[model samples]
Target: MENCPFCKIIERRLPADIIYENDRILVFKDINPAAPVHFLIVPKQHIPTLSDCHEGHTAILGEMMAVVPRIADMQKIGVVGSTPETRTGGYRVIINAGPDGRQEVYHLHVHMIGGPRPWKDNK
Candidate 1:
């Protein structure tokens, strides 16, 4: 956990393009973006992988999910129109876990990808 990049970012040991933050979570732009709007949402606590999460993590997880729409709203990437027929934009949420999932960072995090461009192959 000491050398983890996300931990470093949380600790202010490394720099991040932080867009949002609070006591429970941190949101920042991805170093290698996969879409026009690609950002990461991570917990302040270090939970190595999605698989590591347990029932105790429920609240944090809920908070994480809750923040997504807010971020989407801020980015102007979700719900531009009122009705489903009139809806123009949306967002994508990705969480790669373990070796097979191609997770570059061990820390559990969500990749929020969206905007007006094509979604690329996320690394």
Candidate 2:
């Protein structure tokens, strides 16, 4: 984990466009964004991937999930209504587990992406 990019950012050894930081989590803009508003929510503690998570990581993981909506709100992303009649803009949170998931970074992190649907160029 010593050479991990996210760890370096947390240690202040590297630079990142950090948007938010808490004792357990760090949110920053993704250098290679897939959406207009793309950011990564990473746990300060390195936990290789979601598959590697254990009961000990529950609290931090829960906290991570709890903050996503607020972060989306901060970015002005509306709520994702369940009904078509109530359609509203919102964000998507993703966790890529392995190579098949296209997880370039080994550190466990959630990708928060908002702005438009169908992800214009990502398709």
Candidate 3:
């Protein structure tokens, strides 16, 4: 954990553009963003990848899921309208598992991606 960038952020040893923080979790802007609105939600505890999670991590896992929506809303990325008639803008929550999943960070974290012009224009 000593050399972990996130750990350093948590310890206030490293600078992060923090968006949200609580006793159990920390949400911050991703240095290398894939979208205009991109942030990462990570547990304070160090757990390398989703595959590393076990029964003991249930509470933290649930907490992470529970906070995702709130964080999305905070970032102005939550579904604006949701009804049988129409559904407006929303966000994507991604958890890259391991090497095959393109997870650059070893620590388990969720990437929140959204914005009006989130996707790049190929044309």
Candidate 4:
């Protein structure tokens, strides 16, 4: 994992638009955003994908899931208390694993996207 970009980021060897960090996780804005608001939530420990996870990882995964709503609210992308027509039509959370799923980074991560859904033809 020496050459892994995300591992470098987690190690503070690379730069990222980091929004949140804790002993167990890191959150940052995605450089190439698919939506107006897009960010990545990653674990401090390197795990290739959900498929690689073990029972010991459950608590950390749960913590990450529980934090998503709070993070979304902080970004003004949460459904509750957000102004109508103000880029919070709803959000999508995605985790793409491996090449078949179009995962560019080998590190396990979750993508949180919101704002106006892009035009179907855009992709």
lDDT of 1 at 27: 99
TM-scores of the models, in the given order? 0.95, 0.90, 0.91, 0.87
Q: For model 3, where is the 10-residue window of minimal lDDT? A: 114-123
User: What lDDT tens digits, residue by residue, belong to model 3 across residues 38-86?
Assistant: 8999999999899999999999999998998898888788886669568
Q: 1-123, model 4: which lDDT tens digit per residue?
A: 899888899898999999999999999999988888889999988898888999999988887787788888889878864556553346778889888998888888999888766733244
- Model 3 vs. true fold: TM: 0.91
Worst 10 residues of 4 by lDDT: 81-90
Task: In candidate 3, list every pair of residues with a backbone clash.
Answer: none
Misplaced by over 4 Å in model 2 are 80-84, 118-123
Best by lDDT: 1
In model 1, the Cα lDDT at residue 117 comes to: 62
Tens-digit lDDT track for model 1 on 16-65? 99999999999999999889999999999999999999999999999999
Structural RMSD, model 2: 1.9
Clashes within 3 Å, all models in order: 0, 0, 0, 0
Off by over 4 Å in 3: 118-123
lDDT of candidate 4 vs native?
0.85
lDDT tens string, model 2, 12-49? 89999998999999999999988889999999999999
